[model samples]
Target chain A: MVRPVNPPASWWRSGLAVLVVLGMLPVIGNIFRNDSSVSRCEWDGQVMRPEAAVTLELAGRSVTCCDVRCARNWLASHSERPTLIQVRDEHGGDPIDSADAFFVRSAVVTNRANGNRWHVFGDRETALRHARESRGRLMRGDEHPFAGVRGLE
Target chain B: MIVNAYAILSLFVCGLQCAVAVWLTGRWLNSRRAWSSGWTDDGAEVVERNAYLMMTLALVLLGLDLASWPLLYLLLQSYVPSWPGVMCIDGVTRIGTGSLGASRFLPGLLVTLQVFKPLVMLIGGAWLVIYLANRATSKAPLMRRLLWGLLLIGVTSLCDGVCTAGYLLIPKQEDHLAAGCCTQVTSTTTTRSSEPLLAGVSGTELTVVFMLLWAGLLFLLLDSIRKQRSGRKWMGGLLAITLVVAVLGGLFLVDVLSPALLQRPHHCPYDLVSELPESVIGIVLFMAGSFWVAAGAIASFCADVPETREILPGLQARVLFLGLFSYLGSFSLLSVQWCVL
Candidate 1:
């Protein structure tokens, strides 16, 4: 029977270096890839669309949510209330303070999986128009969508 | 039952493994009986034939088993499109859960098989290393022990076959069940269950600990390579410590590194794999490194046997070096990700 011979130490070292370099190739490519423009919701890690984006300050950091329902759900789960809450106006697509915005629970669902139905608008007329068109109800700015719902509160 | 080319191939490989395992088991028993009866040199040729046949079939089964690990994921990924709301492999895993009128057996078996596949591969790889070392000897002194090892591998492969077949063959309902994906189920926050293990350690701190452990393991492996005879003394201890480090490494990866890699606060390993496909290289390197370390340790233990002592040291050195290379490669790749990201 022939004995198996071990390769030279230098050979092993060279192989190691080559393998390490090969392993880093993809990582190097990743560094150059532009993924910064894509924004994902903080709550569910879903990609956030510009039109339906909601922003809230949690723990001194701005957290983006996909819609009003996610933002509310996030706030309800955390012990500390958000210092600032902002939602994008559906008509103009500009961020507006949640307090100044009119929320319409439209029949049109924004996010089906999370059951998001409320649409935020800077103008009451647009909110009423959306409510009428979609057969939705206007919710007060201070109203909690999940309030009194079991386990959500 | 998402029938696709990958699923068909997996089932075929699994079936072949099952058939080979049964054949090998029968051969092993016959050989054991022959050895027990103390047949003289007249039966040496028969024994040699049996050993050759069994070893050949076992190696093939081992290759098939190793291939099945990757194939399992491919099969799952293929099923993703068929299942609504199933965006990732995690969703495909839930298919068994939502199957109409199906017992919990299918999902439970899938999980069990997932856990077992790696273990089977590790053990089988270690056995292959030992067999090679033994084969280098003129006398083939480790034949009896190798036979027992083969039997153990055969049993595992048989079980793997059964589990894979059950998972693949069991029909799943086409009804689209609203199964929660990894994003919904994987908790971003640290939970009570992990609190004790973490002991309030932050992700950065845990990463630091993990790096330090890897550094220590690499040093030990280097020392073992330099001093082969002395290395035998701590082989068992090294094995135990390595096992602990592996567990800690896995925890660090899933909880800390995965989120960091994916740039998501609430990311799971599935997300990391899906988003950063390159990270799979890091995972594979780490797993391969861990397996080499374990196999080296097992070989060292086997070297305690008088007949196999001569060739085991060289085999152990080579295996330990491989482990070092793999661990270093994985660490370097992860560091690059950490630094760049």
Candidate 2:
């Protein structure tokens, strides 16, 4: 086999110079953007949890969370009281509006590594119906203290 | 014509891909000494990483190229008439007219072939590189990788380019008279006011020419390989014969197997056009160019070299010639289509 080229730092500097001479391509060009926004749940700017009710708000936009872990982390850190409303979907683990939530009773809570609880509704029929019918997550009124709690009112 | 949104998007994607490749290559080069045995043969994994990165980047660009078909379909629906027989599928819906979609065995098969076309060149490049690398490690070096690579690129590029042209010219639909025969020959004198001398220049003819040119290129490639290996002349000869026969068989099969493919083209004007003189010139230019490429490929293959002389570069040159000719030939066939239909 042939010995690969192991050029010195000056070679890299020259390569960079050549690149600069060719012009900063990607940096100078417009990038392609897809129309449909399909961000992953874990990667999205939403918190995941089950017991505590907390809303995630960004500027004028707001979404709801189901757990205390979600409520604590999702709210604005600088403010004493969150001015925005947001909540997580109890069943699907997605963030949705707490006002429009439909929390189901007899929900099973699963433990997390971060001491957070993830609730799975015990009623398969209700969960299936909600999954099929609802566009977003549904949380019941008695699921958490902040389920019916008013924020930015 | 102005570049459409999709084309622009493709260009952007291509640029991004190239940028990512350059960046990734730079990073690999920097971290070469630290690479472990899982990735590279030695501590230096930069070259192997660069090759993979380059291939990935090229594949992405090719995807962008294939995406052009869907965008063109959309354009046809929105801007052009349906023309009744042709099928149209928007980006969301899957459309297949008997055998157009990926689900259908044939059209999907063709599309798949197209996707891997770049790899053919890339593989050849890798082979030449490896060959040179092995030789370089020897007590007496036989060939230089860069030289062989450049030569192959030059030759194969020519052949592939011509093949591409021929492919474009030859209508995908097996039938030549898809639009039906000329009902009226307009008596308008354009640039070239010559009588219809070329009668049998159908889509099938273009397809045959394409297949033949492709075969010739492949034959030359085999010849190059034969020169490298011992006792390979018989195998090379067999391949050459098979390729030629297959091309001929394809031409014959186009008419027999798919008779209903081409109905008589409607509004086909076999007119005395003075304006179409340039078209005749265009055909001549195409044929001449194809001939030149074929000649070069053949000549390169037959050229005798000393056992000590570097021959891979010469082989590479032949491949480039074949590529150029193939593309040019396809274009000519397309021009002929424009003339007839």
Number of the predicted model whose lDDT against the real structure is largest: 1
How high is each candidate's interface RMSD, in Å? 4.2, 25.3
Clashing pairs in 1: none
* Among all candidates shown, the one with the greatest TM-score: 1
True-vs-predicted CA distance for residue B222, candidate 1, Å: 1.1
What candidate 2 gets wrong by more than 4 Å, as runs, is A1-153, B1-52, B55-231, B242-259, B262-341
The docking quality of candidate 1, as DockQ, is 0.27
> TM-scores for chain A, candidates in order?
0.75, 0.35
Query: lDDT of each structure?
Result: 0.74, 0.37
Per-residue lDDT over B1-341 for candidate 2, one digit per residue giving the tens place of the 0 to 100 score? 22456435534543443354345345444444444344455533454444445435434433443443333333323321222222122111111224332323324433443443443334343444334334434332322233233334333333333333332233333212223376433311111111122346665665567567656654654444334322235434533543464444334323321221111111111110111222323333333333333333332233323442354344434433333343344344433434342
Local accuracy of candidate 1 as per-residue lDDT tens digits, A1-153: 653445356858786776779557666767666668777776656678888998876565777889987777666666665666778998879988776788889789776445578888889898899999999988873464533333322
In order, the TM-score of chain B in each prediction is 0.87, 0.29
Q: Give one digit per residue, the lDDT tens place, for model 2 in A32-145.
A: 222124221111122233334455564565444445444544342234344554454555555555454444322333322222433334354665575455432444545542
Residues B1-341 of candidate 1 have per-residue lDDT tens digits of 66889989999999998999999899888787777778667466567779999999889888888888878877876775664455456656665453445533666887888888988878887887789778788777778778888898889999999999988887765333454763223321111121224547788888788878878888988877766532555888778878978998888877787767765444356655556666777788888888988988887766446666776787787887788788877877777877766
